[model samples]
Target: MLPRTSFPSAYRAAPTLCRRCLLRSMTARGQQSRFISTSWLEKQDEAKRKWEERAKLIEEGKIQHIWDTFKDRGYVKDLAGTEDQIKELMVQKRIGAYVGIDPTAPSLHVGHLLPLMPLFWMYINGYRAVTLVGGATARVGDPTDRLQSRVPMKKTDMTMNITKIHYQLKRIWLNVEAQATRFGYEKEPRIWNRAILNNSQWYASLSFIEVVSRLFKGMRLGPMLSRETVKRKMEKGDGMSLDEFVYPLMQAWDWWHMFRKMGVRMQIGGSDQYGNIISGIESIKYLRDTEPDPDQKLSDDLSNTPIGFTVPLLTDSSGAKFGKSSGNAVWLDQFMTSTFDLYGYFMRRPDADVENLLKLFTFLPLEEVSEIMEHHNQDPSKRHAQYALAYEVVGLIHGLEEAATVQDQHKGLFSKGGATEVSSYPTGGPPTANMASAFRVDIKLPESLVLGKSITRILYAAGLADSVTDANRLTQHQGAYVGGAPGQPAATNRGISTGELTFTPIKNWFPQDTRNFLVDGKLLILRRGKHFVRVVEVVSDAEWEASGMMYFGEPGTGRVRLLRDALMTGAKEGEGHDLSALSSPEARRDFLDRAEALYSDEAGRFKGLPSEAFMVKKTRARQILEQSFRVFARSGNQSAQAKTAAIDEVLERAARNLDGHVENYMAEKKRQEKKKIRTSRPADEKSAVRWV
Candidate 1:
């Protein structure tokens, strides 16, 4: 009642009408605010429900959630979607996943294993696993985390790489399956819906116009420019090429194509690829949502959303990336990195990283991994965890049998005892105590060349010492041992006995029968210090003569020969030659000039030995010659001028011999090339035409 009097004019107006209008206005304002707030709350509720659903599914064992598995194993670094989204999609249905690899090199390396782990898991779980080889994109080269554009690969090299990579990919799958079976995760071979697809298959026919019209329209410049990689490049002021700038778009097209054609919903890559992966996800969404074809457009459902998973970039304990760019790639190819070396690489991993590496690399169970770490922590000196990790990984990449052989080789070569019984040999013979020669031979000399040779001469020929003088010095200090396994031999020159094996060490200088030194009448093991080992396999005269092995008197005579026959025969340069005729300086100079002309020829580039093999041989030859010069220059028997003169003469003779070998190599190459053209050409016109 007091308020009505105090309100005066307002209270005097129609109270009922005023009250009705006020209630109506308040309701209108309330509805607007409620709509805005409830929309946000609805989203929160939906998210919570999804999370609960995912958790329940994991609990009930409805699906092995990829997110949980990857995250737990340290495989995940970034994800394009929420964890709930990934879990829900995986739990709802079996989906397709892929990883793209550009065949920039001839082989995959250890760094490439990160993303492949998730793909492997998906494949075994009956998901479509597609390994997309970026044959076309390799030419463009991904600019992710790169400061400069990659050197463009030649078409011939690219083709060779693709072929080799295809073989490697298939081999990896087979090896992975075998390894998975060993880990008690067996799946039907027929259910493995894996494909090693070359992106060139699609890109070859896809014109630039098609790319702009179909892919570019869906991409936004804002996000592309905002990418961390692009931003970094711009800030660094390193000129970025258009090809590099549009690299993400090209990758986006790859994923979009996979999604539409193959139903692939997930893409796995390294963390550096997060920006590119986001681009891919966005592109998929844009295309699917705005597709012109009604049948092709995806339904507006959360399950249809594409996902991206990024694994942490593989790094060493020092935090350096393990990749070709870093120049520390451990190649997967046996020729590039031998099985023993590969095993050793893992075995040398630090104890701090062994547990994490085990989870990442091997398919071992978590409980077992914990047990291993527990045991390793107790006695880190033994490296039990590293041993298990190395064996498991080597077994996965190379077959289990090769793993076993490599293990045996490791123990025999580096174990406390020099000799270890091996079950197999590279020659595929019976078990042997000669494990050093079984797996690897440092040199192969003809029985005729080695049987009557002095120990110093043999050592020099084996490339163990720089010269005869160096060989004699090495023996004088007992730094050299012959006919013993490679390790600490017994204190006496008589022999070393370990278990049932007795190895005799010979350290004599004069020419004597080597029958007592040779093992099985074919193998001789030489040790320099505790680590450097040289295993010489003595072959039959016929085999050695067929090879490029040549003996040109003693090391003091400056008689140089090819250390590896692979340089000549493997280079398709025909058989060994008798270059004894080129002893005269004038004759050798004339031969060298002729050889130089062939070597400079463009065709000679393809016909000669592989560049790597030739470079290794040339480097070794240069090192030996330099060492010989140094030793002769320090000679106490001759004056400085006389020593210089003698060194010059030795170098000239060695050069002459090398020139003769080159001449023989190029001349043989020319002959082979001519023969090839002749054989490939059609017969003369008169021969092919009828003489009507």
Candidate 2:
């Protein structure tokens, strides 16, 4: 089934012009509409008119462009197909190719896409394409590169993952089909005849004897043992199992299946999968020869059905295999990785990777991509190529409008740094997704903003502090900040709750002061520190106290008491001293001083503090502030100092602390240097030096 558009109205408005249609329309009418830019239309015309010329270039298999593209993008020698081999293949006729994706995980990662590109290119260039899902094979677990043995998947989980994967593939294939079909043959635009097939459909009904018979027919035991992936594991005493040994044979069977069922002649994937693809081709050759005349040669025309190609594994400029980001694999699902995070990841890709990624991922003309690359290389700070890559990928996957939305939100969150710039709605309404990473929702302020709401109540309502005491400790440490402004003193424990708080990039947003609050447009994102973030909105008191609600505010009194008790209990258990110990004014002052030190030096001591010990101290201060609420009620007026001055003080203090740390380190280095000199002196001279 074709993938359904999430928003049909969008396609209706735009008329869903595929590349082929656009090209044909331009050639026949000799006019370009706004939707079909004049330059883009001209380029399409040129490419279509001169298809044979490029075909010859491809036929000659001059791989300079392909090599340059891959090399610039950080790929080195590929696992199987070399630069020379790919060049030779390109000179050949339109190939029928297949890429097998095993739904080992619920979703495909960016790593998987690297290998999928060769098949995609084949489809785009008028070759038949097939995407084979390993629903049957997933249960067997292809033990190729795994260091440790993986637990076999349950049939149920494997089925579910495959279903989800099938849906994702449908979306990707449809998008690719639209682009690929549009790129060539404008008069009779070819529709991509892509298939998402389940191997289980073909293999499930086969008996064990049948499977065994086929498995041994084309399989070679010696070559299987000789495979690098298998040999290395065996040499390391990892003990390759029979199933692991038979993995290539089963994979080969997939190619053979495609060859027979779909008349697919080629198998393309990552270099790592070369063994499997080659094996599959051999299996097909063996099966065809052994079978009857009509089935012996599946294709009469070699040009249309010629087989086998694989793309190089994508990597970064550092040669690190391209898949992991911040130690996690970059998944296609929004839930797995935010759109913004995805964009940001692509946006920061090295120049080398950008050129190759464009060839692999984007349908943008090679010439235009090259132009972008040239400009990007000239001035990398502009990040034109990265942005282009980000734009194209996001647009292809999520659509142009969604991509645009994500880009805008990225600017607002990172560039502007607060919720005021974003659209504010009541919380519980549908969330606004940006760059596919962050979500914006409506958040109502607590009654404390206008009313004489207590600090504990406000904190509780905002979900910042658990209890009044928890609020107090966070406030005491200066850990909690509203709209990038520090909270008031702890004496007046009544928290003034506003309807919205935004999670903006405050400290890291260009530059800022101790407090620079602006309700940019409508959104209110509050940043607590380098990491803690909250996005919220303000609402009327009636809304704050409303009942029969989906999301309601916490009761002011109960919240405060809960916070205070929680803090008190924590302090008693974690800290040696009880809350009563701080009853004396002098003791309270000392405790406050210690709290100040802890807060100021948090970054330095963050790693050293035991989790329980830190929580206890934080809670104790919170309880104190909650109990002595009156002390914190004083609202300090905002200083008229320049933003730079306010920010400079904090930056300078931090700098000085860092400088002091460096000085101590230097002194230690000097001590070590002197000791080394003394130790190196002759024995008699060393003794004399010690006496001196």
Candidate 3:
């Protein structure tokens, strides 16, 4: 820490003053301690000229050249500062801005998007960005914008949350950069870097007294108490704890630290943080003035000063806050909310808020936004603006391919009188690719299979549509859909299901450039309804067993190893733990029962591990187990009846009725299926009936 400047020795004994007033006459020692200059700053006149040009751009609200928002809708207003100050720091000095979020959860929802939009603007317009996750401050908890106080989070939980958020922030920045590249902005000489900062580094080491001295020494009780956040808490008279009151001070300190350490001058936050932002600005100003540095005189220009900007509270046309608090906020994580759901959410935005949301959430040019709004006005029902907004936002969050899939699914499914039924005949892409909206499972075709065979055999071999009796059962109702030749319209083929056909159809959904995925120069993709998809490669059974493929955990867990050993020795479950005994339906059922219990237990306790590494373990287990059951169910094995029965029960248990036809929530998927079973099935058939 730099000490305050003292008066020159010559004036120390003189009748009137302390060294604070005579800074210019400070000793050589004081001068060296206070001043350090960098080439990042420019000459006084040059910087001032640049500032003037930017200020004009700001006043005009024209992002024509610099592509930043100052007085436009993007600007909610600076924290009691002039627009010129904002422009000067952002444009002329090329300073960085930041928006700090506490890692209260694993993912960021739409509520965090508001502040990030401007931070994105700053990034593209040649400003640096440092996104701080409040790893330390989260421990103390911020009292702003809350009716009740926050419960403290465990260290492990906070650590896990930080890891997940760090991943998300990095992911978002990459997409932003890619967007920038398309805009030809990165070609400029400036290098853009997005930094992820965890606040624990500084705060974790400081003692309470040290914190008070470094940050709160200059904070006044009157002003702190008078702030809206504090006043509200006081009004409730819950006898506010010192921890809650100091929450704002922690945020203020964060800004001050960023300014000093990372050269981050602008603090961007939501409207709720207006008071905390101001507090930071005050503390920074006071510290700069009091820190005894001779170099500070060389930088008397206002460009070095810290400033802040706030985003207005975002809401929908209904006046409800655009947040998860209302239980409708969209999440960035796919597990919490699917890509299709996100697309639908934005695509159905009310006309009143679509334009504003576009400007705020997307990087589209305002001129283009205006044009889209015009087109939308001409035909509101066409939803031109809403579709554009949805595509852009979804593309940013996921990718262009994912967004395109949603659009295709929506258009294909809704084009026919809002029909949820899929065409028995191929409608969109190639017949095999038509099921692309659902899923992709990899399997192996029998080496002896011949081309131009039958589609029903392929479905059975892929463990897609259960038993022939089940398929017949489904067909007798409305008819169950299955993938085959693009032009074939049969709901189910009688020949293949009953083992009458020996050859298989070559029709597949696999990509044309498939050098990497092919086995024995042959790979097939199959689909059943809108949700179920399977991939089969033509590899001999002998070749598959010799391929050294073990589907289990890294290095194979003990259970997986035991199972593999049993498969080699044909030992029974408890006696030798042999997988060869898996032929027995009883053995298969016993193994699945135990495996199910183990997977459920691990999934239930996954949070006990580092979330970044283990969060998806349970989901993966269920998926692999489901696919495994299908492989066995379709195979030729001893004790056929027992094997088939055991495989069916386990597959049903693993799937939990998520088979292709069982629609969860999305109606769009219902329309993507190449074949539709419009008729309802018996309750037992609709559900995965118990066998054991």
Candidate 4:
């Protein structure tokens, strides 16, 4: 089907704990969440109940910390810094967990959900959330998902994108916090206290030399080069530049600064960013360990050392990525990607992907997601899992109201067997296709074409059976049925048997069927059998004339597309005189052949033709060809003398308009040169020349 257009982390125990010894002692966390109905009100109530149950688990030893619970639930991927260290720190303090986002676009897309959603989790779990806008990092684009370096954005464009993303991120973060607070999850919601920092502020003051020598003093060269993002680019022979190479260094500085200044204890990112996450953690540990203290009390206290973890990148079984660079991404901001478009993207999630996407992307309980999948699998056609996934993801990002609005619009399109209201559908297609099997009615035949036209001509114009002979053979079985109009009540009443199929007009069956056969004065749908259907639209002759386009079809179907190539072939020295029409496949092919030959002859001699001769002669030639075409179209007969007359008249007017246009072009060129010379002249010389 052709598309018309559419639109977390916890910290660990103190570093004093021996890493090898504690690795064996680490206990995986678990929690039970209550299931809620699809009702929004019930879901709100369920949230409060789940929080109460979570409190019990925390006391009963079923769960170590909320961050650990998240890790065990399969949210964290490529986790860096031990679980032992992170869990201990979370238990002792409410640490700030930060995720940095570069504002390369004015809006964030679905691909960003892997990293950005962690901030929401941190807030609901009573951890401080910091969503950083990488205003500076954006200037040096992230080399994470690109094969080639990005074209730099203008300052005004970058600033605009940054400001818009700031508002979008803040809005979602605040809404999530408010919802959690209303559920009594947190009396003093940490989300209200959350921070949205911009890295440009720090980078603006920090110099390149300072970053390399001081901040990166503890960083190793081997690890930086071995990072996956860097490795892939180098192996591909499209290696990253110095600016891109040091991007992680700047990101590391982000973590180091946040750890010391704001006390952010953890950094979270997508699987692709685990390498950068590690770099930040290492740089932070180095800075913290190097901090001078007379008592040396903090030396062994990995107590508050920053730790980092990554969320698994969502992928289909084929390993095609699902987020930002996946190419099929949708923007988070409603204005950029319309509400209907964003909702539809998730609602159409492939069955194989929906189950995993539900687990990774949404806040729904994993068990509930399983239940949704069971129901979805039972009736795959119903797409219950897709709806639930779309609902939660859309509600999370765009709020419940916007989500509901889009869902309603989507249902209205497909709920009643695809575009139920004929008035609402586009002239060229259904408002929304119900399935891939639905036939598209895209061809716009001239209104004049419908009157007494043979089945062969109709089929050819509609692009259904290829040629008139093919159309005739396909209809021989009497399997054709055509009806969908004011006079015809049923969907199929007409048929063409093999004996009556040859060169017969379809209007013979229903008498005046073609007069009102078009649904809403535009569409005609015909079914060849149970499996094949085609659509034809009757368009006014004026419309076709204005467009100048010969046909609407799939690639390689446009009849006149070869006109230029044919003309080029005729330009050979010995070929110019052989102007006879070579092929005659259709009624109009002869005229087309002659027209192209004439155009080629003129074009070949274009270099030597005079302005008056070229212009006056071509003007007359156009009139002759147009009149000949009209006569041929009406009766498929144009005399040889008429074509010769067109050639002679065209020669008289070909060059009439050419000289005036050339003179005007020369005058403009001279004016521009004078302006350039005056501007380049020295100030003193320019003043003396102007006075003279």
Candidate 5:
């Protein structure tokens, strides 16, 4: 170690300021050792002194208001400053702001709402709002979500997704145009002003030198290393590329450009973006052309610049993130999520989150929201809050008229007072039966959404299907109603169009989860009930012609590696020719074939491991192999039955060791029992049923 005298007294002394004080001071001063204003320093000290008092007030509801109430509804925390910052920003300058969207898909999803809310808030509050479409960024996919790197898109595909996303946004925001239909006018919220922008407009025009100068001038490696996200990845010994490391830098550059060009002063995104947000503020302060005065010095505070805020992840009742039910995303585009399906999803949100959902995603006033909350609390079984929440959000997204129509259709067929079943909807759609006033979606019947499901299952959900015999004869004797018609004499092999099907009941019941089935647009809705809708948006003709998936009939590059590995593994294990002998492409095809065979042979044994192992590769394989080894350790080579018995024993023991920590827990429990339960029967005897 260096001599003690080498260190300064300040370094040796314990820190006088608390962490929050330090954070504030650092944010205020930012790299400067010198203080600016005496009052500012005093304010910091006061904040420290009164921290507990302010926290108590915040907890006790003294500071509660519309904004605070909104925050409680899942609005992000740690937005630059307190209420003082908001007042100051409003007084100082009319801040211009933006939210970024990458045109990676044809539609938006509910997940994208987090940033959109802030953009709307800024727009409504006397600030200029800009919606930045990342036409350029979409081509080079953002690494935020993907574990592996994304394949760079062709310029044409990028252009198409960008155009598609633009239209979807217009629908979401209810953009006004000459072609605006009733759906656009009556349902969707009109939030944006005149400033819809594409970052490609600026980024495309920049020279290489200009790009470098703007992005790299003051960015050093030290700060990058210190970032929590980066540090976490490095500590895990995971492979993080230069691009992954530099991604935040690129995002920071985007903010700097916006700040300089549009006077944008705030950035809001998911919690994952905190590092990028901080970097953006740093870039704005230090990289701008205007320099600080000779007398002025940098302060430590980071909160004084463009504000950074992040919302918590949305989760379902089971405490898992929303859209994680089956490990698939519920996309916002009509092709990805149907309007009716979307409505039903919001309907299923837990009562605990109704207020948060409204505050985060809707424009409901505080008083109305409170009333809805009270109604929900009074009789949760009534599902009043669920319907209202779903109706308002779906109307805002798809249009009020459509929502009303869906509701009317639902009531006509399913309501107890209405018809008990629906033979068919007037429009060409699914032949639905057993409709209910009480809305419930079927995730498995998009084909039958209003048309195709057997009347029995529809009635089953609606309490109509009583037994197998009742269902079988109803179809056998042509007694079943379909699209307002009696069942066909025999099951036909030919495919039936939507118009051809007829229902017997003829009463209207809203299409149970009919949200995905769009009637007019080329995009068709397919529902798996209320919860699962897949929107297949019509690709532009040009896009269709250019797509390899459309013309060549195959998935694109960078997706065949796993299939190839599987094939090779199967071949090696099966005493067949080596898959390695084939070219990479051929190997991939072979792997997919073998993998499919294996899947068909033993679905339960193969599905979980193959998908999981293929994705994570080496790490997961090692873990599984190690566990398997431990399980087989005591199972020596012997007759199949004896070996199997030994294996089973070892596995049970391992499971107990892994899941229950049985040995340690049992030892501790014995000690506790010996000390505490003196009069009881022997500890093991109570649980035992053994015979010697």
Candidate 6:
């Protein structure tokens, strides 16, 4: 060891230095540190003082009315500021409020609806409503409830998602505005004040250095580290990422930007976002309090200070969260979830939850809601409350017209006396005499596949079941039904014995005399369960064979084969396959042979194949064609001239075949008519009518 005299003075004094003094020196140095500046602490004190003042106003009952509307409807779960502060800000001016949505998906789900309701209320109440799309931040991936970082989205996909979400937002706003009017909110929303912004606009130009220098300085590591999300991740040893840790800082920047530019003083989000909301409020306070001029300090003014409001997370009766993660997300986009399915989702809600759902989801008056509930409680099986809930909510999301259509469809399928058992042959005529009230067919099946096929095979072919085994299971479990009309029952019976169609349970096989089962000798309705119903129109054998041949004669078979190979080899899901591929003439011939085999019998008529087998072959052929089209289109390998020539050839053949079929059909009909006329004539006149 070196001699003490030779050591540095600080090292020599280490043993004798007092622990308290050392800690004091470190604390003093920390206060002046650049990351957590002294001014930030002062700003915290100022915020506390303002909170105390707001609390006093709240105690005085001055701010109670401000939150009453939201509280009554269960919209308010947590609020950043006291009620008085919110009241004061609203009373002073038409301040802006916003909710940010990350385009993690192309469509918003029901979970997003809770927070959005407050924004809609604000807009109609004459406040500026801002919907911020997280174009830039979505790229970062919100780490709020995730155990792992999100898979980074491709640039193209992100762009598409952003565009779709923007359109959805606009559409939803229009829907809400229309719904509000029907709910008796006469004041029209200021459409001009509603803004849909993409944060990428500013983030694209924002430099990393600028973000760190300006925004990060106001954020403290202690609070961020202590957040429930961060702490949970750390405790679980999952290891948090730097991007996730800095996510709140970016969100803070968003709020600050909106506050300064849009006069937005409020941010609304889900209760899980409480931590992020706090960070935003702190950021606004820090930036405002640090302003050089005292007169320009917005945080010092009560009305100017930003606030955050959060609604409860939407959940089921089991208390599980409602979202994609839970695998139960009900999407607002019609393409993702049809209006019929959406209406059914709410209709299926338990009686215990319907009343609360009505209160939360609809804008019907409380008195009306209570009266409806009382009536519903008297006869719960009638589902009066569920119908009201389903109708109003469906009307709100999808227009009232769509809601009405779905309602009629639902009633037609399930209402009492809507269907009658077919135990005996019809007393009068077939149900199809009055075609106006015939059940609308949702899918069309080839007659060759349906007339003698098993019920299980029909279900699989109609896309109602995943596989033949699944279809069999459904039938065995009494989950399959055949025959039901989709329109309201006719008021007049006419010659028909039953004015309403009836669904009869089907087992392993369809009836051998399927003509009696068919409506107008064509249409068949198949129901898998209470929720899934499909009406199939059985096309003639001639039409079926012609359609298959037409598909086969189409151009670009080579490209389609190549695309199918690429897809089979594990191309990414949703990858475009529009480019052309080099293929041999032999390959084209082989493809045509396979298509011909699917529908052609030894006698050259349509084959009597099971619907499942027919559909499988048809689907495989179509997939290959579609895949090829997509690949060649994307690759641009095929020349326009060649594609056009192939299309023209196919269309010419198809048209010729169609004309021949029509002529044959008309000729057969005329021969039948002549036979009828001759048979009805008297014996003496019949002998004279036989020359032709």
State which candidate has the highest lDDT. Answer: 1
- Which ranges of candidate 6 are over 4 A from the true structure? 1-66, 187-192, 292-299, 414-692
lDDT per model vs. reference: 0.68, 0.55, 0.60, 0.62, 0.50, 0.67
User: Tens digits of per-residue lDDT for model 1 on 188-220?
Assistant: 443457888877777756799977877787677
**Cα lDDT of model 2 by residue, 1-692, tens digit:** 33322334443334455566555655766554337578767765664555557666655665334434444543333333344554444444333567788887767778777666656655655556788888767766776666555678654345446545665676676556555555653332443356778777666555777657655855677777788778777877467887777777777777777776666766667766766766665666666655556634554333323346556765555666654322557777555666677778888887767887886787776788889999898998888898889887876665566567667776665452333233222234332222212222224563334134443334444554444565566556655554422343223222221221122221212112211342322223343333223444445567756743323244433334443354344342445545566656665655554553443344454343222222224454433443443333343423322322433454465566556655666677778888888778899886666532
Each candidate structure's TM-score, on Cα atoms with residue i matched to residue i, is 0.54, 0.49, 0.56, 0.50, 0.47, 0.54
Model 3, span 523-576: residue lDDT tens: 444444433445455676578568765321113433434434433343333466
Compare candidates 4 and 5 on lDDT and give the better one: 4
- Top candidate by TM-score: 3
**What is the clash count of model 1?**
0
532: Cα error in model 5, Å? 26
Q: Please list the residue runs of candidate 5 whose C-alpha ends up more than 4 Å from where it truly belongs after superposition.
A: 1-73, 80-83, 175-194, 234-238, 289-304, 322-326, 412-692
Candidate 6 lDDT over 551-627, as tens digits, reads 11123343434334533333334433332321444544444344444432222333332222222244444443443
Cα deviation of 255 in candidate 3 (Å)? Answer: 1.1
Model 1 CA RMSD to the hidden true structure, in angstroms: 32.5
TM-score result, candidate 4: 0.50
Model 6 vs. true fold: TM: 0.54
Between candidates 1 and 6, the one scoring higher on lDDT is: 1
Off by over 4 Å in 2: 1-94, 180-191, 292-306, 316-318, 323-327, 413-692
RMSD each, Å? 32.5, 19.6, 22.3, 29.6, 29.2, 24.2
